[model samples]
Target: MDCEEARFGLYALLDDELEVSKNLEILSHLEGCPTCHRELELDMRVKSLVQAQLAAPAPSPELWNRIVRRIDQEAEVARRPSGGVAKWWPTAAALRMVWGAPAIVLVLSFSLWILHAGQVPSPFVEELVQEHRGSVTRKRGPVDLPATDPAEIVRHFRAEVPPSSPVPLLAQEGARLVGGSLCHVGEAKGLRFTYEVGLGRIVSLFQMPRPTRALPFWPRLGPRYIAQSQGPGVLVWGDARFLYGLVGELPQEDLQRLASRMKGI
Candidate 1:
């Protein structure tokens, strides 16, 4: 099976809804393809994590009855003739006024449900994933500012970016600073540092000013925070000044270790 087909059936396979023949084909493909196997593993892990974190409470019967009654009342109102103050208002406008509150509630509840289920990723997570994917998958020779010294990269960033921005030097046994580039996270100016880890593994550290809006969900890993964005693992934390996010195709434990090291600096 091709990667696309395997991915298409991944959800069904995980839920044990696939036919035996199709399941065997996907299994065979996964055994031969490390990328597909890793993707499947990550999906399962994320699913478990979400299930553990979120508790879905059943709606109270009273609340359900109230909602049904409200819907019936609105329908009755719509069927009635225009009268009194509502006579001047258009039918569509009247309907909107009656349904706006429930509509908003439903929208927000759906958004939160999807987010908690790990079905729809946040915008910040999406941005980080795109940036990391571009850096890793690009058919390029080297990064923009190729340098081993973190100090030199900081100096370059200070010259190009905001001088007041804090650029912490990140060092670990299996990782070394390669280069960096100026970037942005939302409207905030930021910097992305690339590191070369063991066996050509590339990791990216993105930093920006602490965003005004807090993330809906980011699990704490010691003093830092860790999240999985699609396939890559992301570790994020902040000091008084800046917010930092590390993205790579590393295990959660490995990413947590890296985040701990970065947090110390």
Candidate 2:
């Protein structure tokens, strides 16, 4: 299967709803395509998160009592004969409305939660991670621009890529630049800087325009900075003009250190 075909059936494949033959084809495609594989992984993570949230703890006894009382009232109404209506069975419409309202409310609440979740750092971090994974797996030729000098990369981006902030050049020990490229996540257009840390490990940092409102999360390392793991090691922080997300597979401690040293733009 090609990328488009594989993506089309990704959800079905994840939920094991696809036929065996089609599933096998998509699996084969994912095994060879890092980009598609990353997308599948991301969908799986999101599905699992939603499931966990929906599988909320049992309601309190008082809450259960309230629900049972409501159900009992519905049952009584269903049993009572009204006008020409028989009591043998309730009308499908009434049954659905009475029984489905709670579930409908629950689903709506979950949807709103997902919407808010997509608003800031978590979803944004996932977007950066996908971009980083793409960069890691993309083929590179010898003719590509050199990336050893962080300053040169910064200058290049500033001069050539309009409407971008100065990408931070890590001054930490044993860190080296591994080139950069113009990239976008949703409506935010920016630059992606790849780097090689100890033992050839790769990390990528994405810089984009600062969001109008900041909704930060933990482990709150600073007043304006917050970091969290989402399928990879992700550290998100922002300045007055731009937001940055550093993504990699390095230990969170190591990632935090690298992020902390990201000063002086």
Candidate 3:
């Protein structure tokens, strides 16, 4: 299979929706192509992350009945005799009838199920977790632009990341500044800073502009919000200017201590 075909079948392969023969073909292609393999790996990780975080509730019998009734009504409309504008009514009006209420209810039900599961991790936290894992596991070091001085690193980011969010020099005792990198936290441009504490433990600090709307679901940590149990650990906070997130494998208390230090910076 070519790259395009492999990519097209990737989701089906991950979800086990493909036939045995098709799955084998894609798998073979992925094994031989490093780029396709990485893409598949990233897709699987994202799906796992989303499924782990979001809860899917079983659709109620009444909801199913309602959807069936809506479909039946549309079918009846389609079978009706055509006259004047009524000729176009079956094609256009039936579609609106089928999709309007039933589609909305299905979407709403799914949304409620996700919301009911637990606190939803923000996109920023998701990106931080992925970056943290990548940094720790990769054979090479993490930083793209290396520097000891936080100011110099911030300067580099300002020139690189658009809209220029401030990269705070986190004041945590024993935490040595490693360097920084330009990255994306969700759709917004941001900067990531790596720090080392005792025993060569790594902590990542991510900063981006505050999103237009605040997320109401995330758990609060003092003034900041936290997305825990998603991966490693992440603490998020922000003000009028920028949103800041700290991620690491450190204990919750330890991460909180690090976040608290940043509050004064």
Candidate 4:
């Protein structure tokens, strides 16, 4: 990766959002290329220091009030009764302004918030999870990522993941080691890992190596975020180099802890 992309990756790696391919790329380069590696190390140091000084708690009630008020104002427009001229148009316009405006504002504001949210990068990962609730209900379709023995799963991953490395997968204790597989990433032709959890939960994970097209920092399509429209609560984040995304509804914190456990959280 070049300096500019490497710089964005450094932050993504620090936040643990870098994609696996990117993770391997930056990390591999760091081993052979000293300059980029050193820069990444420095970025991590700064990221930790900044995170440490974060406010102890979320915004206080007073702050929330101000925030909400400002948001409301940005979305608010006086609605007038359309008694004469094109009666339908006025009501339609009012509805459009009411719903459409807030939706647009929220989308834009969220984009700004996510650009720097660190631990959470993609805003719609949650939306993807919400939509995936249906597939679970059906018991069919979606990529058939079945489970297998951990030993066998390891071999499969090693064969598929280029540069072949050991990607950890420690499902709940007592749970069967099912299996794991590499799936086509998104439109980017990248790759991701999917593990069929105990009985129900399925764990899908991957990292962004680099950005190619004019996709959002967080690549997604239509109802699909990271090219996935259905799945449990999928988590996406990055550090200095790679972008990471995990799909599963298993408790948010649990998922985070699981991810942390897989690598060096």
Best by TM-score: 3
Per-residue C-alpha lDDT of model 1 across residues 1-265, encoded as one tens digit per residue = 7999998998899989999999999999999989999999999999999999675667655576577667866886887776777556566545655776797688889988865665333345434434654563254313366565888888877876568777765667857676676665545666788776654456788887775665545434333566666666887777666788888877878877777777355
**Which residue pairs collide in model 3, if any?**
none
- Poorly placed runs, candidate 3 (over 4 Å): 1-143, 161-164, 218-222, 263-265
Q: Which stretches of candidate 4 lie over 4 Å from their true place?
A: 1-147, 164-166, 171-175, 189-199, 207-231, 239-241
Question: Where does candidate 4 have its weakest 10-residue lDDT segment?
Answer: 222-231
Q: State the lDDT of candidate 4 residue by residue for 1-265, as single tens digits.
A: 6666676677787678978999888776677778878887788778787889654555554576456655654554334343655444544435546776777788889978755563443455444433432333233323333445656655655554555343545544533343333444444323344543432455666654545334365445421233233335666655434456777756666566666656644
The best candidate by lDDT is 3
Evaluation by lDDT, superior candidate among 2 and 4: 2
Candidate 4 Cα deviation (angstroms), residue 124: 28
What lDDT is reached at residue 197 by model 2? 70
lDDT of each: 0.71, 0.71, 0.72, 0.54
lDDT of 2 by residue, 47-160 (tens): 999988663556555576567667877987777667564655665556756987898799889989876764443434435434554653354311233465777777767764
Clashes of each: 0, 0, 0, 35
- In order of TM-score, best first, we have 3, 2, 1, 4
What is the C-alpha RMSD, rounded to one decimal, of candidate 1? 17.9
TM-score of 1: 0.43
Each candidate structure's TM-score, on Cα atoms with residue i matched to residue i, is: 0.43, 0.44, 0.47, 0.34
Count clashing residue pairs in model 4: 35
Clashes of 1: 0
